[model samples]
Target: MDETTYKFLMGASAFVIAILGLMLAGTTILPEVGLEKLRKARSILIPSYFVLALLSLVCCLTGYDRRIEPASTLLVASFQALLFTMSMLVFIRPNEVRWKTVFRQAGVITVAGLVLFVSFFRFTDYYSCFFYSGVVAYVLQLIIYTRKFMLAYRKTVQEVEDYYDDDEENRLVWVKCGFFSALAVGIMALSILFFPVLYKYFVPLYVVFYSFMVMWFVNYYRRMKFAIPVIAAMPQEADVCAIPETVLAKTDGVAAEEAVAVAEEAVAVKEEKSGAEHLLKERLQKYIDEKEYCRKDVPSGIVADSFGMSKAFFRQYMKDSYGMDFRPWRKELRLREASRLFAGHPEYTIEEVSEMVGYNNSSNFNRDFKRMMGMTPKCFCKQFQ
Candidate 1:
């Protein structure tokens, strides 16, 4: 492509990137993530990214193009900021290890600062050194991101070794795919730097590559929009799931007291019974005791099917015997098992427990956990520790 075409392409790509940034900025209220540090991290990163995209677009549109020093600085700096911002995001995901994440963020930032400082000194001899340095820095960032992703992948496999959510596992697989795709584009852009003689010819290529990165970023943003709430809610759900009897015994309000009384009566009937209700309870209890309901997708039909019964029959039987339907009954089973797991393994995180109990999304787990448990997972764990 000619210089005119390349300039237009860069400008157009920048505009698209700015729009993506705006879309990302549109969802600022993350009721999922409870940590102030994470909240601050996202609040800063999104606005900063949006600002950088806008600035780059402005630079591209102005007479001061990529060949010029000022525009080049703005564009390259924007790319570097994008890389570093994403790295920090990985550090802020709902993980059990905060110190490690903090250390990684500090290390990446320190290294980035040093690289930028050194590249600036070399900038006088070679203007493209600024972008060349950006490519390398992004490579380093992808390395950090990939490492963190690998750790998360391992956690998904090792912690919940037996149970796996196909959809959840599929999403985890995409984590690597997204990072690798960006890294591959980064490498393609970086390799062009070696052939500085034809770098202008490749400038359009850079625009395409940069656009690819932004597109991947949009995908990440979309994923997080849903994932954050689940991640935020995991702990509360697990802890509340841990102590069912204790949770059920408390009556903070009239409605809660009635609910607790109903649960108690149900329990009392189970203890003092030998009829259809007791028989049904025995069959379901035995199945639940065997850790069968740990998968979050355990529908009543599926469970009943396993026991050679129809979904309708099971649902009616559960309602008649315990004044409840399948959903609450299954939740009670999960909570009891999760509580058992928490009491036995105090070190187990909400993430781990949520996974074990079949919650693929931590945000949903956390929300449900709080709604039912009345306390966060971390708070519940602390009571024991």
Candidate 2:
């Protein structure tokens, strides 16, 4: 590469970095999602970019001296290290991921990377091997998130045509950016190792990619208008690392909104489920009272059908509403009614009373009543007498 070309690239990158630093410092770069973490991230971003710009200028100043290349490499490595550290702060999930954990992990990565660079470049004269050592930890972190994103993407697409959900979809935004940024880093690192000449231009190029991805995440997340629920469960994947191109951007908002309404029947899932459960309880109670359904030899199907609900859902409703299974609860109600009949209508024979309550045989009724109520029917009646 010619000196003129190198100077031009470095000068351009420095100017761009300076502009981005000013934007970060002024907090004018973000869209206003009303999230405090991102605001705090912008606060940290100001100085990090300024330092990165300074480092780039220093590297450009010492470009002619091959003897000082190791120092330049170390400086660039330090900048990369700080880049990921700031990234960790920016994307740290308040509840799902801890800030201290990210800080400690970034610290360890920086230390380990510096140690490897020193050992390789100074001791063994292998300057190239020190490359990408700074990024290993953050890349691994992104790889983990990438896997999560792919799994989520696959699951979401299974039910729908695209990946735009209003509920918790915004949560995956940063992870998607992480996946792309990590891919760029991996490619750049590999290219520099295999083709040392690639480093001359690839540094500026990869920096451009990295900076755009970071800035996009910040602005995009801030504009992501939705409530963040608990991070949805990511489906398990074996060893898949396939990255599809730029998924979250091309989603059809009209189609997605329509699909969500159709998927959930034009109601918020929580609100719909809540309202349905409440109605189910009310209707079931009304059915039971009007028909004395519990006193009948009622099949679960009959009881559920009377309330116009599926048997399975009715059982779930019973458990959720009353904290017991449907059949046992019906039996308890029947036994109580039988006790009331025994006490009030003493002249009615046990067989007659049992038959009225839908019992086919008095002996079976007495036995079940004894088992549940701890007394025989006649004994129960005697006490009432």
Candidate 3:
């Protein structure tokens, strides 16, 4: 094919990709529209995409006439305009701040983009001013959007934390996704500032960035795992689900008081039965107290077996009473014992102290010590001297 034909094909393909993106975004939002309004918006956007595609193809074929090209430019420009308008509309509607704020920020960008287009219209004569203004506007929009997104994300994170403490793993995953989404949006906006001079190259870069964002939302919705249970009688009211009795009991003062009383009574009755149990607990505590457990890389399962209890039951009991799993509890015990040893036996090097604490690696010991004490073990020991 000739050079002109190749350029035409390339421009047409880019326009098609843009249209596909627009179609995806459009369909995703259609469920929110009133039935009567839906048909009208779809009609306008669908035809606009085809018309602009054809116009872009024609401009490429006819040697890139500015007037002819501007039609295609306007088509591209209209995407931002629609985005801005939608953002403003959502902002004005009640209970739509998330959508509204997003769109409003987008709208500001779209309006500023008109200035960038005007710069391109006079690119040869005022190239520097055009580039600077475009870059400035893009940067400003990125900052505004990033701030708004982070604020909304923090609000959502707190809500998630308050509502679902049990599913902490999923909540953390969503928080990470939300952070990356904001970062992606910022990167895409920054990429656009370069598009005026290097339009052909960065076009695909923008497309891929946006595609990843859409995929992120899809993944987030999928990973929320637990279902919101349905309630028939209170159709309008929010659904409720059963919380673990143990979790609820901790917070209910009367239940907690009753539990404590029952625990004391049980302990008194079980004193004779608990001679073996007390001996086992004491052995574990002594190992920790003497720093022997820290010196050896002893598994909690092995400890439980030595004490004549199943590892599972031992883990459950420790978790219920102490609110820590075996590994962390043991680590804390070892670290505490290690801290004392390190302070008293100043002749031992940091590496020797680490080995004594059951940490195979000095770096790991240092990290754990700093995490628990807010300082390195050596620094912590120096305070005494």
In terms of TM-score, which candidate is strongest? 2
Q: Candidate 3: misplaced stretches above 4 Å? A: 1-111, 115-131, 167-201, 213-221, 225-385
Clashes of each: 12, 0, 2
Model 3 scores what on Cα lDDT? 0.51
Off by over 4 Å in 2: 28-34, 64-92, 120-178, 200-204, 210-218, 229-385
RMSD (Å) of each candidate, 1 decimal? 16.6, 25.4, 13.8
Q: Among all windows of ten consecutive residues in candidate 3, which has the lowest summed lDDT? A: 226-235
Ranking by TM-score: 2, 1, 3
| Model 1 per-residue lDDT tens digits across residues 277-321 | 455677887886687778655445557667655555566677877
Which model, 1 or 3, shows the larger lDDT? 1
lDDT of 2 by residue, 1-385 (tens): 4566666666667678887777556545443343455556566557767876776676566553444443445445444544543454344332333457656755775676667657665766554445445345445654665564466554443322111111123344454565556556645654454455665667676567547745655464443332221112243344221111222333455577666555554345456557767778788678657646434334565566666666666667778778987766766666777887888998878888777765645676787789988989888888766
| Residue 66 lDDT, candidate 1, scale 0-100 | 31
* lDDT by residue (tens digit), candidate 3, 1-385: 2446537555855576566546544553323222223233334445544554565566466654433243234325435334423322222121334445545655665665566566666565674575566556545555664565556545444543333221123333444454454455445445444343344544454445445434433342233322111100112444221111132234445676688876666666456335645665777677656655664434555577676766655666578667987767767876887788877887778888777767655776788789998998879878766
Q: Model 2 clash tally?
A: 0
Among all windows of 10 consecutive residues in model 2, the one with the lowest summed lDDT is 159-168
State in Å the error of residue 271, model 2.
22
The TM-scores of all predictions, comma-separated, are: 0.45, 0.46, 0.39
